[model samples]
Target: MSKRSESFLRSRELAVAFKASIPVMMGYSVLGFSFGLLAVSQGLTWQWPVLMSLLIYAGALQFLAVGMLRAKAGLFDLFVAAIFVNIRQAFYGLSLLRPFRKTGSLKPYLIFALTDETYALMTTRKIDPRLKRRWVLFYLAALNQSYWVGGTVAGVLFGSTVHFDTRGIDFALTALFVVLAMEQYKAKRKLLPFLLGAGASLIAMVSVPADRMLITAIVLALLGMFALRKRIEDV
Candidate 1:
């Protein structure tokens, strides 16, 4: 192809990626804003939120880090917690192996930027094959992170100045998860995985302390899914 044609195609891919990422943009902005506001409210400075959003970029883990930081948690503890919280991303990465194989130097950044929303968009949306797949994926990941970081910065600025009730702001993250889960269910039309997940969570909640419930639930769900993998795949 001619240079002009290549440039135009690249731009088209970027535009498509940005458009597809708009839903995540909306969700991340609100959720990141909530993280920033909550972090500051809990006595963390604006810098922590901005830095974590830019570097860590894991929504749930970042929120958890706020309390860990406040409690003066050690590096080993933080590392363990981060692993447990983001273990699901390891599973997310498995699904994207083929798509990311040709990403070259972009592979590391792509992996780093694979938040739940980005993964959902990539796996669920049908992209035009004519577009450069790697570039499209790269743009989608980059654009989503930019939205999150921008929201975190805005939230910190807002929280630093204003002082209203931030009581229910954290619900934004949970709401986003619900929407994503609903979208996944609609797309896959599968019930077994959802049922197993809910059952594991309930079991974990009853068996474990509140502080350990999330990790326990995730472990239980993964084990259940693995044990029933043959049935799930058949369905």
Candidate 2:
């Protein structure tokens, strides 16, 4: 193709990817801003929130890390917590193996950037046939992260200057998850997964301390899904 045609195709791919990522941008901007504001409020330097958002990019874990940082947690403790908090990403990666196989040099960055919102957008949104899939994926991941990082920076700047009550701000993350879950249910119309997850969460909440509840629920849900794999497949 001519240079003009190639440029046009690239722009089209980026436009489509940006449009698809708009929802995540809305969600991440608010959550990431909350994280940054919370991190700074907890006595962390402005650099910590910006660095974590740029490098770690794990929303929930970054929230958890604020306390860990305040407590001066050991590296090993952070490592373990990170693993427990992000174990779900392993499952997300499994589902994307085929689509990512041909991503070439971009594979590593794509894998690193596969946040929950990114995964949802990638799996649920259909790609434009005229645009290259790999480029679209790359643009989506990049754009989402940019929104997060931008929000983090904005929060850090604002928090450093203005003091206000941040109570209940963390609910933004939970609200984002609920929205994503609803979107997934709408797309798949799969009640079994939701039922199993709710059952696991209820059991874990009753049996474990709040600190341990999330991991317990995740483990139980994984086991429940595995046990019911055949049934799930049929459904």
Candidate 3:
């Protein structure tokens, strides 16, 4: 293809990816801003949120980081926090191994950018036949990160000026999750995963502190899926 035509096609593919990633843009912007707000409220500089979103980009973990940073958490605390907050990502990568095979040199970054929102969008959103799958996936991940970074920077720039109650700001994370869960359910119509997660969480909470609950729940949920592998795969 001619250079002009190649550029045009690439732009079109990027547009489609951006369009598909709109929901994530909305979710991440708000949540990332909230993270920025919370991080600054903890007496850290606005740079904290901007850096966190740009580098870390994981919503829940960033939220957790705010508290951890405030409390002066040690290396072990940080390590455990990361594992608990990101454990479910293990399953996400496993499921995407086949779909992401074609992403080639971009595969490493794609996997690294596999936030929960991005994962849901890639797994559930239909791709246009004419657009290259690898490019679309790459752009979706890139655009989502951009939105988060924009939001965080905006928050950091504006967080100091605003001085109102952030008493319930953390709820925004839960709300974002509810939205993602609804989208996934609509896409797959499967309840087994949700049921397993809830069951394992309930069981885990009974045995561990709230901080350790998610990691334990993920472990139990994985084991449960393994025991019911046939049923899970068939579904």
Stretches of candidate 1 exceeding 4 Å from the true structure: 1-3, 171-235
Q: Candidate 1 at 70: error in angstroms?
A: 2.9
Could you arrange the candidates by lDDT from highest to lowest? 2, 1, 3
**Per-residue lDDT of 1-235 in model 3, one digit per residue for the tens?**
8999988889998999988999888878876777788778778887778877877878788887777666676677678778867888997679999989888899989988998779888889898888788888999999999988888877776779988776777677777679988999899887898899899989999998765665678779889988988887688
lDDT of 2 at 79: 76
Residue range 153-227, candidate 2, lDDT tens digits: 999999899999877776666776799899999998889999999999999999986666666787798899999
Ordered by TM-score, highest first, the candidates read 2, 3, 1
What lDDT is obtained when candidate 1 is compared to the true structure?
Answer: 0.87
Superposed by TM-score, candidate 2 places the C-alpha of residue 57 at a distance from the truth, in angstroms, of 0.7
Provide C-alpha RMSD values for all models, in order.
4.0, 4.1, 4.2
Candidate 2: where are CA atoms >4 Å away? 167-235
lDDT of 1 at 203: 100
Q: Count the backbone clashes (under 3 Å) in each candidate.
A: 0, 0, 0
Query: In model 1, how large is the Cα lDDT of residue 151?
Result: 90
